[model samples]
Target: MSTAKPSQFGVAGLGVMGVNLALNIADHGFSVAGWEFSPKRLAAVQAEKPYERLKTTGSLEEFVGMLERPRRILLMVTAGDPVDQMMDRLAPLLSPGDVLIDGGNSWFQDTQRREKAYREKGLRFIGMGVSGGEEGARHGPSLMPGGPAEAYEHIRPVVEAIAAKTDQGACVTHVGPGGAGHFVKMVHNGIEYADMQLLAETYDVLRRGLGLSPDALVNTLAEWNEGISGSFLLETTLQVLRKKDPETGKPLVDLVLDKAGQKGTGKWTVQVSLDLGVPVPSIASALDARNLSAMKDERVAASAKLPAPQAALTDEEKQHLAAWTHDALYAARVVTYAQGMRLIQAASKEYQWNVSLAELARIWRGGCIIRAKLLTPLREAFTQQPDLPNLVVSEAFAPVLTRMAPAWRRVVGTATRLGIPVPVFSSSLAYLDSYRSAELPQNLTQAQRDAFGAHTYQRRDRPEAGFVHSDWS
Candidate 1:
């Protein structure tokens, strides 16, 4: 019952990402109808000649008229509530077979709800995860689409052509049904937060603790970027520190706004981890760091921030702090990335989506928001063992961590003695220890679950259980 035609698509919202994506689609020879609420924005887009054959429509009806039934509309609007607003405005004007694609960092739950509602109208909806940032939007991105299998077919060619590719081919694929695409994107953001916090903490230790200059810190970071810890986030942090303010000749980062703004996916990642019964302390710490960053001004004014007393650092102490922080950062990064991949795996399993974890990793190897060369090994690791707990736990990663563990411990102990906050790093080390723990009290959890929900329990001695518990005195 679909009515989509080839070479017809529409990009709604003329934000930077949307405009670039529109240009990308148009460059692929697809006729696109670009819609924007602002006349100025509409004119600006027109002025850019993003697409030579592009059409501009002020009316929703005219935009719909540009395509056949099952129209393809990509919503490049803001995440959360704005997505719902756009859908409400667009739904009534579309026909039964139309398709709505959300290219924002929307909550996966919202995507699921929207898809259900759209289904009732005999329309289709897709929750798509697109990374590679603004630059990638103009050239290529890592695209993850989740929804009807049939709907994917109509858009696959364009998605493939516009996604970052590996040695094999294009990087895009149908992620899975429901909200898997958005869910995966949330994990990506969470991992991003962890990665950023690790590098920041490293900078703090080197600067305040070791009295290294910004240039030194940048040098150290660049070195890390060359190894397993090497990734897009670390590389970018180095670049940011390299930026100097022309006005005062100070680092632009020092004067740039203190309150770091986020689009909420990182918070959602930690929240979802809690709900899913996953231990994501590293990710949680990263989330807490973001929250704390927002309160920087308030914290500074509170009794001059009541800075903690400094401790004398012995050679051993300095060495330990450096080592421990390294391990923690390295381990935490692995956990956060693994947690994201696991989330994607769970979503794919739960929704019957055939998303290729390997392919997703490959897409991340280049032009997308989270792109980094490290993804090559990650993609390869997954290909070898799809059920890996994390990249850190893999045989390939063991030697790397083993070499890095001593440094990680030193850094952690030094931070502990100095009362320096390193939540993400500490949480990552904690996660590593917990994962490698030989025994956990699962029996107690089972007992609690049975007590609350009358859930069945399995006894150690017997396959079928007479539920029992021993009270610890």
Candidate 2:
């Protein structure tokens, strides 16, 4: 393969994400070499008005040779088999101290396995999660990098320079060793699912229940952007609501298809939470809602077979509902984030990742999709109490939850009464209620399990260290 002058950084797979990230690196003043597997993609990139510091080559051998010693190569390819395929091609070309970074929405288990394999070969593997879509990639994205601490120094300058920054610092950090970065990213996506689903449910409630027009909704969201409810998604939601369909002169959002698409990170998050025995009701409900949304035909058929909503709210009641909905959404968001943080805590313990929850909040504050006004308080909460088990119970948030409890209940009750399926809203309330309750109905569940499957359970009257069995005839 043909060789070129060495670059300080190399990015493989010149797709949208790859190309933008390469430009971002080059914009940060680092010389970047990029590789594209397909000749067409290579030609397309070459045709672009090139950045002086950015170089492209189609050959993997030539790409590897173009990187400086102890090379740092960032792969933005598709996850799963494609990542493995790239690793196979690069393994022989990389030297002992050379670093390989996977910047994709990959499963954390795969990252752990790959890191182990690469470490055995005296190479470093970083499973990095780069958030922020095409725009963020071109400008600045939040970066979560997990690998050996020793190897981080090699790529830290480029990473920090290209990452979004807040008053705290750049939105890039060594999350932990091995798969921690991907694991955190998985939870981030799950939270995003919950966030978007909650917003959609809120929209449905306001649009259908309150009969608010798209323009009205957009104004409301824009107003919310200046308040505690402000977030990137909320800001983006305003943009979506403001768009008009050129063909029909209707709101673009109304004209768009309802079938929500997913790339499996939400599913992976739920699966990992189940594996770890962490309750992520809001996230799970969000994922389930997407799947349910996908079955559009079945839902339409069922709508014909099933009864339509009959309960209606008065104008005054609708106003009250809107006010309560704001508090409800905020409370639900708190629970959703708490649940996601809990999952990270469980994974950190199981994997000994030493993940900083405060840092997570800080890094996520700027570049990521989930960035919000709420994360500032969240970061402060975690900083104040690093080992805080749950955000709802934390000092900074508990008072907010306490105040929002009544309004949250009112919104959920109103949605239920109106026959609006607020799955995320309802699930988030359920999660909060379940978390706050000192007593639950699990005793009977334990009894049933013991009776049917001989699964021993602890007694409520005694210490939980002993698993006692009961015979119910």
Candidate 3:
């Protein structure tokens, strides 16, 4: 008789994320079996002996065999082709009712298709969005899982056990069915891009306009973090600013290249938003900023020919710049999140996901990269009105925005006068302004389209008439 015991959970693709997750599962007293195609990775994990309850194998078959029946597996591989290849290989080995989770930043449509295909094969496919980086994985991460309800039930215990916990509860949820999890995660990344860009812009303005040193900047941000502006990214920024290069003994961030890198999620968010007819200009602008940053050489060359505005801040502007920027940062951040949430809402309605924005807010309160203090009231706003048309108009935020609009405008105006680029700030403010306005210049746009192309327009007086064309000859 064999004296072997089957693992409760299985993980394929033992990369950094996979190994840490496996270890996390083991730490929670679940026997975990990990499969790695790379012998080097397998050997390294085995040598580490991080957990006695965890086992690693290079053989996929052995890895599957060692897992308990109706096996629960997590595929932490690169998104796209790798996920499909692994699914194909695992299909023959998995029994009916087995569950497989794709724990990557995958395209939501891909997840939807994979779920359908797996269901046809009598297996359950879950598109799970695991947020927080390596450290979060080893400790805890916010988990967003969307799949068959029963399938979620199967792995819920393991996930909930390993997920980041807040005062409310675990940072995990059954987001919805199909690709809802990935969709939400995509928007989360989009919001992350905007928030990061907002921070970068703030840093640039404060550093250049105010002549604040790194230490001074840290102090300002630290004070902000103690209030509603507190966030994982802000804290990380402070840490980065505090870091000194060992070799040069200078602020490490200053020595680093100005170029930014991305992994396509931000672009996907913008693309999907357009498809769903949801405007996310803040996120769009952030994506554009990254694209523009990539052309550093071009920018350097253009700087010589293109002259910047030579305006300087007045005494009044000097005294209130930081205060105004603080308001702009908070207000713009709210708008950025509003855009992301609205995008999610549109997708939810389009796909019938029934995702609770409140639950998402709760889960995002900790662990995730975009975790912020604002999520609390944001959650409450959704709870109070599940069908909130826009977060800017939410009861909790409307007054705050009204109060802060003056300062936000001041920040934008000051930045503009100094020739500082604040794309997200300006775009987000425009989004807010457009949302608040009952009448817009789009009436002229309609007339122009109708005059040139005979594209019909709807009249305010007779909306029942529908599609009326005007002749301007």
Candidate 4:
């Protein structure tokens, strides 16, 4: 077991994502040491499974001791408080040049704090955003690593080598300093929320309007995956839909619950967008859907208690509704990604993240849940112009929106008329239209910001950096 300076990789947490990433590292030929608090959890690693390269250490001290000098460890633990626990325990034990990588759904502010804390200990802290979910963790993850360039140098080879690769190459890249990676990841998740919302709306239309079974929907999704709409998440959604229900004769997806659950990342995405003065309406609406789903009991009661139209729907109207919904979902989904990328581009300028949007799109294409083949053109567009303001105006994507907008509009009109809550998709289209319009009703908003903060604002007449202060009292 003791080879002269064998490259050792250790994962500190044994949670689902952690376990899968550890397995991936081991599966890819790197020697791995995994540390978990519970012996019972460690027993699962010992169990006869496909990946055997992982060796569980008895204690935290022991795990830290196993790695060679300039040790590299990835903390795949839950984000927030628990991250500090690992740092506190290991900072003393780790050498000056050792690296501690955080690969979790942590806030960018937290990443900055942790990186600063670890730097004082002389142990480099890498704030990395590791995406691709469970399967990607076990196969190829799209990794965004940010920290000291030296620390990145030590770990980049391992990370890039193990990351998910396209036919062209690896999905991993150095995102930038401190919180940049996590910030980028946060935006990525926000975009994902909007994308999934669109897909769900499309599914609703297909099911309600076309009278398509889950199997039929799966077929449609699969076909879409082959075209410009193609993506890893889309491909998987088809798989999830095609699965048969265990208790019933229908598709498993049909039998499954409708409500979607969310972790904090999506919320963070919306919050960050707000803080940055960036509009992510589609993402916000998607988050709202999950929030509404969580309020099912209240919503159900409201439906029951409120005076509502308890009427039957006509078949023709239903078909029209579905057809309209599909188009709306597509347009909204595209706009959501556009907004998310724009937010990141704005941040890149502010924070000096030096992020490569092309690599980001490519990395997202495979490992992440929102991945799709449409990302290839996105990646290419970004590569050509690293600081492109928005994915909406990208030459490759513009034509798509131009062609689809009319259809998308028709769908939105039909859904609204039918009283369907196509929030994610509809909200996206709304925001898109508003964004393109030269005029926006911002007088009220500016009045409010000025009223409270007395924040300086430029006069519309002069349009200069000079402020026009208002005395509200």
Best by TM-score: 3
Residues 404-430 of candidate 4: C-alpha lDDT, one tens digit per residue: 887787666555554556787678778
- Misplaced by over 4 Å in model 3 are none
How close is each model in CA RMSD to the real structure?
4.0, 1.6, 0.8, 3.2
The lDDT values for all models are: 0.77, 0.92, 0.95, 0.79
Model 2 per-residue lDDT at 398: 94
Model 3 / residue 461 / CA error / Å: 1.9
Off by over 4 Å in 4: 1-7, 50-52, 305-327, 443-473
Residue 272: error of model 4 in Å? 1.1
Model 2 segments beyond 4 Å from truth? 1-5
Each prediction's total of clashing residue pairs, residues at least 3 apart in sequence or on different chains, is 24, 0, 0, 5
lDDT score for residue 55 of model 2: 90
- Two-way lDDT contest, 2 vs 3, winner: 3
lDDT of 3 by residue, 1-473 (tens): 55698999999988999999989999999999999999888898888956778888899999999999889999999999999999999999999999999999999999999999999999999999999999889999999999899999999999999999999999999999999999999999999999999999999999988999888999999999999899999999999999999999888989989999999999999999999999999999999999999999999999999989999999999999999999999999999999999999999999999999999999999789999999999999999999999999999999999999999999999999999999999999999999999999999999999999999899999999989987889
TM-score (C-alpha, index-matched) for candidate 4: 0.90
Q: Write the per-residue lDDT of candidate 1 for residues 1-473, one digit (tens) a residue.
A: 54534338888998899989988888877778878888888888777744556777677766777774568899998887888888999888988888899999888888999999999988899999888888789888888788888888877877887777677578787777888788877887787877778888887777767777888778777776786666777778888999999988998887876576777888888788777777677777877887888997787897376777678678865555544555556665666677678767766666676667887787667665566655777788889988765677777666766777667767777777776777877777767666767877887888788777777577777866576544433
lDDT of 2 by residue, 1-473 (tens): 54556799999999999999999999988999999999998999999997889999999998998889989999989999999999999999999999999999999999999999999999999999989999989999999999899878888998999999898899999999989999999999999999999999999989988889999998777877899999999988999999999999899999888899999999999999899999999999999999999999999999888886798896767668878888888889999999999999999999999999999999999889999999999999999998899999988899999999898888888778888899999989888888889999998898899999889899767875699777877
TM-score for candidate 3: 0.99
**On TM-score, who's better, 3 or 4?**
3
Better of 1 and 2 by lDDT: 2
Candidate 2 vs. true structure, TM-score: 0.97
